[model samples]
Target chain A: MISLLQQEIESQPEVIARLLERETHHIQQIVAQLPPFDYALIAARGSSDHAATYAKYAWTTLAGYPVALAAPSLLTMYQARIRMAGALVIGISQSGQSPDIIAVLEEGKRQGRPTLAITNDGSSPLAAVADHVIELHAGPEKSVAATKTYTAQLAVMALFAAALSNDPRHMEETQQLPTALEATLRLSTPIMQAVERYRYMDRCITIGRGYNYATSFELALKLKELTYLMATAYSSADFRHGPIATIENGLPVFLVMPLGATFADMLTLAQDLRER
Target chain B: MISLLQQEIESQPEVIARLLERETHHIQQIVAQLPPFDYALIAARGSSDHAATYAKYAWTTLAGYPVALAAPSLLTMYQARIRMAGALVIGISQSGQSPDIIAVLEEGKRQGRPTLAITNDGSSPLAAVADHVIELHAGPEKSVAATKTYTAQLAVMALFAAALSNDPRHMEETQQLPTALEATLRLSTPIMQAVERYRYMDRCITIGRGYNYATSFELALKLKELTYLMATAYSSADFRHGPIATIENGLPVFLVMPLGATFADMLTLAQDLRER
Candidate 1:
């Protein structure tokens, strides 16, 4: 029998396709309500936080609005000022029950800022406090790895962003993401065989840039959670600054390179990581 | 003889005082010339990136301006359009030689945004592109751990931020920082004994919040660099989101908690980590 994690990982493409096909109009209505803002504050945790990081780049690259990853302590601990007079605050979560994620939207509401909740559960506490909710609609994610849920979160943001920007090319790409994901599933046998070579692997670096930078963080977090491997994520360009020192002669570093404007830099970094 | 790391770690309060005493007028002039911005983009790598993280909270809390930690590849790798008009872009570095950091300032300049460089070397390439430079003046730091330079960078940003906001209490606190660092040195004996207790430990988590969130990342990086341990840093709020699962009974999770607005959250996170 196939592992639950593997099956969930393979479910991403279909899950994402369903998200866009069924929920595009729902997303469009929510996007229509949000007033344009100069900045965004995204609150999330774990895999959802990784998705927020991706949204930072995607929102910045496609829409010109800069995004900040919210440290919930600012709200919960210090009662630090939210300064959300005209900002868009987003909270993302898989379980939609994280108190920190819930509090961000609550604080956003108190500050009178436009608040949004992108979560898996429609009735989760996070959705309750949010001014708007876009449920992941990916169904229940039981495996601890968070495979389908993560990709679904990414799809939600991608579709939201594409609709907000009215970018047809991005919309088309979002529609085709499932087929690409199915192809990725077929690589499982080879990937499992490849993994067999590193049964005792201890520590490594994961690198990515632009859209895939979120992928690097997600992969690193999963590696640590599932396999107890020490995987640190870094931007490909940032890796050259000082982290290259950490790489010894045979230090295994993984690159989360996907075809994008950031691909060339990843290529250079990968080559340098191998050569050095 | 004291190790360079400890000596530098203990020099922060003094370095910060000197930075404020001598450069406050000059920094004030820079601040006077630059208009207030809604957001800030800080670009750096490694320990400097940690300093940037501190500045994110500091600037927001004190100056009420949100800051974004630039991924650098956003400029060099993807060449994303830096919608930086009227934005304050600050590039930080110790060596003043990181091509990625330099590229961020270059892009900032091209976008007609005000640029600032905080670096140890005033004559470095990063300075050449920046509209203004605040030299750390911590002198040569040959050690790889980045003890003095990191603290000095933190001090410089703090001073710059305090001056911009014209907050006297923060300025006074800045002046007293070095004395606190000296007092912290007295903890070395216990710290060393504790290190001896964890000789075989390979993985751990470092937690912090608000002003000292950056300290978590810096300490984690140093632990990985000097001790070859896998240490990951998380904000107290963010840590509770998902990473708290990794904590088992007796797991070694180091915290860089100092007395501040975030101290209470650190205490709560400590209890959670210990309980689970």
Candidate 2:
């Protein structure tokens, strides 16, 4: 019998495939309806914040829109006034239950900024406040670890970037992502076996940057949440600076080696870590 | 013998005082000579990235200028074009040796944006490329863990915010921080006594947000750097969503409960952690 988490982790390919194919019109509409703003401000918490960070990289490099991750406590805790005019405010949450995120959306809407939400539940509070909502279309994820919904959120945001840029290549790659995910899932058996040695592994670090830096964060969170591993994440470049001092002999390190312009540098980091 | 790190931590007051008193002219010159931009883009790594996060909170709430933390690899790794015009780019570094940060400053300069660097080494690479440089007056910190420099960087950024907004209240607070830090350092005797139970502590989380979120990050980093503690940092609001699930009895939770708008929430979070 597989855990609910394992089941959901395996379901990502199907969920992402569905998200790209069925729910893109909503994102397209969001892209069309949003105000022409100089930048974007995103509000989220937990895994959703990691997803939002991914969008920060994508929106800058792909769409030429500078994206800033909002520290919602500025609104909720400090009670500061935010200038939302000529900016798009996006709230990313799976349940849409995070009050801080909802506050940002509501505030953005009140300030006449175009507000958008990417949430699993369109009926959730975030949706109620947002001017446009792009449902994650990831159905009822039951795992305490967000295996399916995390990937689905990534796909949805990737598609969102694609829509905003009118870039067909991104759309084509996103459409093919489900297949890539499926092929990748084939290693689960070996990965399960590999974890047997690390049952007592107490310390680790995850390194990534560029487009997949958010993946490093989410993966680190999942590892900590589900396995109780004392894992930390750093950008590959950052790892070189000083945190590398924390690495000891036999310390486990995880690298998200996504192929792209960052691949060569990540490979260097991987080699450096191996040398340690 | 007390390590250099401990000495540096104790020297924070003097370093910050020197910074505010002596570096005011350079900052004022920067304020007077810079092109007016819509917002700020900050680039940093490791502990400096944590400092950049503090600037994000301050620039948004205090100065009414939204700041985006630059993902440097977007240009260095992905070879992507960045929109830098009409923005102020700041690179924060202790040594000013991070190539990734230098890349951001160089690109911002090429794009004709005003670049300012805050660093301990006025002669380091970051200074050569910047349109303006504010030296951290924290002299000769030899420890692997930064102490005086981090606090100095924080003070400098606070002063920058004060100057940007021309807020006399913030300026007053900035001026008083050194004395406040000196007074706070007086508690080291009790603090050292308090850590007896946690001398063997292996796991912890540092919670803070708003003005002190960067303090949370810095504290967590220092714990990892010096003590090998598996310390993590989170905004109090984000902690409640999931990572709180990781808390067990006897886990060390350090809260940076500054007396500001975030005090009530930090108190609530401290209570919740105690209950757990």
Candidate 3:
């Protein structure tokens, strides 16, 4: 019998495909109804917050809307009346049950700003307070770790970003994500073999920047959740800040450097780390 | 001979006092001259970024302006023209030398938005590009890890928040920081005695939330830089999200629960960690 976690992990391509197929037109319709928001304020936690971090780059780069992740404590604990004038508030959660996240969208609605919720459960309390909801359609993430919902949330963000940009090309590009994810899943044998080498590793650092900065964090979270490793994440540039001093012999460092704008810098840092 | 790091550490009360005495009126004047910004977009790295994190809570709570930390790579690497229509772009750097951070402010200026620089060097390129500058005034910082300048950056943010709030009470509270810091320094003996036990500890996690969430990261960075320990920071609420799974019987966790709105939550998390 396959473990629930492994089943969900392997089903991501299908999960994302179903989400894109179902949510693309729905997201555009929702985006069309929203007031002209100058920027976005997102509230989330765990893997969902990591999704927000990805949106911080993707939305700002692709949709021309600056994105800020909300300090949910400000709403729930401090009772801060945050000025939301031209902002759209969004809440992302797998269970959609966190009170702090709900408080943010509630506060946004109280201030007469548009509020959106992206979650696996459309009928969840988080969706209750939201003016619009994007259901993940990933179906019951049974494992403690959120795999399918995380990818589904990212797909929803991509769909919204595409809709916000009013560019058909963006949507067309997103249509290719399922195939890309399917091809990437084919490397699981090599990935599992690579994981075998790091079995004894108790600690590691994951690094990336720009869009994939969120990937560094998500990868670290998965390691901590599944393997109980003392894993941490940092942007490649931020690693140069101070934590780089902690690097020593036998320390495992994972660099998520896909061939993109940040590749050269990450490659150089990899060399620097090798020298150290 | 006293190490420069210790010298700087011991001088924080005086450094903070000097900053308050010299920069209070200056920050007010700069604030007065600035155009009304709906939100703040801050660019920083390392310890300075932690200060910006402090502002993300402080400014939003006190000044009622939502603050977002910039993804400097978006401007520098992706060449994304971020929407900054009503944003007050502020760059915080001890040296004011990082090009990625400088690129954020430069892009803000290119977009005809107001830009500010908070740095120890008034004539640095960062200051040259900004419409306004707040110098840290900590004299020469000789330590590799920033000590006085970090606190100085926080002071500047407090001053700005107070000014933006147009609240004399906030200014009055800011004036008490030096005395409070002085009192905190008196606990150095006990702190050192406590730290003695952790001498052999190689890794740890620090937790806090709201304003002190910044403190957690800053403390973790100090531990990593000075002791070469694998230290990581998380908000107490965020800890429950997933990272709590990584905690084992002997893992050391530092809880920065200053008495305030977040104290109760942090205390509960500390108890939870104890059980784990």
Clashes of each: 3, 0, 0
Residue A237 of model 1, lDDT score: 58
The weakest ten consecutive residues by lDDT in model 1 chain B span B77-86
Error of 2 at B238 (Å): 2.7
Candidate 3 regions exceeding 4 Å error are none
Model 2 agreement with the true structure over A183-248: per-residue lDDT tens digits? 999988898898798888876888888887888888888877877666778887766766677677
Model 2, position A73, has a per-residue lDDT of: 77
Question: DockQ for all models, in order?
Answer: 0.38, 0.54, 0.79
Best candidate, DockQ: 3
Per DockQ, what order, best first? 3, 2, 1
Model 3 CAPRI rating:
medium
Ranking by lDDT: 3, 2, 1
Question: Model 2 over residues B201-231: C-alpha lDDT tens digits?
Answer: 8768898878888888888778777776667
> Which residues of candidate 1, in runs, are more than 4 Å off?
A1-7, A25-34, A106-112, A128-132, A164-166, A200-204, A237-252, A261-276, B1-14, B25-34, B109-112, B128-132, B160-167, B198-204, B237-251, B264-276
* DockQ winner, 2 or 3: 3
TM-score of each predicted structure versus truth: 0.87, 0.91, 0.97
Displacement of residue A233 (Cα, Å) in model 3 is 0.8
